[model samples]
Target: MDDHRIFAESLAAALAAEPDVDVSAAGSGPAALRCLERAAGEGRRYDVLLVDADLGGHASGSRPAVPVQDGDEEGLVDGISLVAGVRAAQPAVRIVVLAEKDDARRAALALQAGASGWVAKDCSLSRLLTVIRGVLRDETHLPPALLTGVLRELTAARRHRTESERLVESLTPREREVLRCMVAGLGRKAVAERLFLSPHTVRTHMQNVLGKLGVHSTLAAVALARRAGVGPADLTGDVVERGSQLA
Candidate 1:
């Protein structure tokens, strides 16, 4: 039997061990595509596509994790990309990426690109089988370590973007001027003098800017302004390093 057939047999055997599962396997992206196409044509559909990250490629000699490639730009086929391609070809099928521990980033990318779930290949056979079944049932199964990291990064990026937009929308011309001066490390009195306004007016504008930004102080306002993409040239000096603790 060919490698495809062997892989299919192994997968079949694994599924057979689980009495509740009834899985059919396809060896390659093209074969999987055809399977889905035929199923759709006949008004049928498979539950999921479990894709191995390194398919039809040799492992790198130096780094076991890497794949050997023929060219630089047109690199070797990655399993996550294959999942994306399968989803593109068969919009009706759910895709699950089977990747190694080091491929967590790639797996995360796959999820962002529309894969339903990611399972680490090194997981126990029972866990792997269970995750596959879960994916088939349209559920996401991620190891706790990987899931936490992915959630943290995604949340941080989202908050950064949101705060940036709000800060821009809330800034008035005079307040923006005061912010620029404050960011330059100037004291309240100096900022008022530079803008030719009363100290009380400067303090009032600073309070409004802070309240609108939902930040505690002028230093935090400056930091939020910078994160919101306000250029340093537009402002005066370096922003205070108030750690990014979202209120």
Candidate 2:
């Protein structure tokens, strides 16, 4: 949700022009929630949501003060709050925060709220669309810079790569192969094709991967793996060779 009516409408229009896509717009967080409810009532659900960091200007008088964590200093309207609210409403909907600038705090907050992606507002529509598709395929768009900071933030809360590493150790060889492809942003069919496996086999591997990782979704598994440094960068030829050597 955003306060800018023109910008929101323009974005919705552009997205609607894409093939096999439907677009809807809301100027505020509550409005967006209402739209989601209405869509659900009609047996429809959104796969992704693009939320503005700032929901809008003050409704009538005072700007809303967002709740912050122990170390957070700012009390202004935090878009991360909206991300959490949206997650509460629709746990399955992937969320991408539209940031006005590249702020580390904003990125960290979004990640902490379980947002799937974040993109600067000034980024090209093509980039945003790519991010949307990527997130839908369970890819996190966190740049290395932001990821470093987010890792530190999570570290402070006793939730960091160490935990992910522990979980990773529990994965089977086949499950690690599945996770490797997943971290590379491959969908189930693509992963199955690449691994020379049937779709049913891929699904089973994915479920085992999720269970071993102690996560509910593929995105969470990939995120945890990346946080533990078992990301696309680590899925090198040597890694592939190791997987192949497995019985």
Candidate 3:
């Protein structure tokens, strides 16, 4: 036994019913890490690590600590980070993220961060057990709805990366600069001002970029630019654009 009393209890109960498996529990990320470290130190290792995404550390005075906001430099240890840490420490261990019903975004991030699979907490205990066993066997155990979303995002990201590389290869240096501005949602006049070109020249480049991208409108051009990895930082100068399109 290590720490997650609730999940550990449930898993223990399930494994008890099975009679062929041994299950252990940990309450916090640090405890889980410690358990793994000790097991490794003792030349023992578990088959898998199932991490809950919302273990908000220890509750102090009846309320749990709020999670750190996105991009926080302190690097808060949510479930995803916990699993990443575990993987870093024990690369051979399989990891499964236990997410909430609406955790599609977090689940996608987890997969990108190297989690083997994701299971929603709302699923049945039997389903959870099955997923746990499946992940232990080096198999994917994603729920159907979550699997669909993950696959869609993965495909979209791949397409965007591929299209961006092609655009970079096809465009001239100046055209690439204009496309970067467009990706930042800048208009013709704004792009011209940033590049020290006339508005007419900017418009001409925009049209050429659009034709090269096979897009029909400024909006479509911007969408294609984002897929090419053109962000505000890629802009020629500090031109603040409105209504940026993100992929």
Q: Count the backbone clashes (under 3 Å) in each candidate.
A: 3, 0, 5
Sorted on TM-score, best first, the list reads: 2, 3, 1
Tens-place lDDT digits, model 3, residues 1-247: 3334555555545544654455555556665666666666877766667666675344421111111111111111125566666677666666677665646667776776667878776677678667656665678766677777877777877887797679766877778778877777778887777777779978888888888888899787777676666664355445434322310
If ranked by lDDT, best first, what sequence of candidates would result? 2, 3, 1
The lDDT of each candidate is: 0.59, 0.67, 0.62
Model 1 Cα shift for residue 94 (angstroms): 2.4
Best by TM-score: 2
Residue pairs whose backbone atoms clash in candidate 3: 2-26, 3-26, 3-27, 4-26, 4-27
lDDT of 1 at 165: 70
| Residue-level lDDT tens digits of model 1 in 111-195 | 7666777776666778866665565566887777787777765567568868677776777767776677767777889776666
Q: After superposition, how far is residue 48 of candidate 1 from its true place, in Å?
A: 1.2
In candidate 1, how many Å is residue 27 off?
2.3
lDDT of 2 by residue, 171-208 (tens): 88778878889999988897776776779988998998
Kindly give the stretch of ten consecutive residues in candidate 2 with the minimal lDDT sum.
Answer: 67-76
Model 1: which residue pairs collide? 183-237, 184-236, 184-237
Question: For model 3, where is the 10-residue window of minimal lDDT?
Answer: 66-75
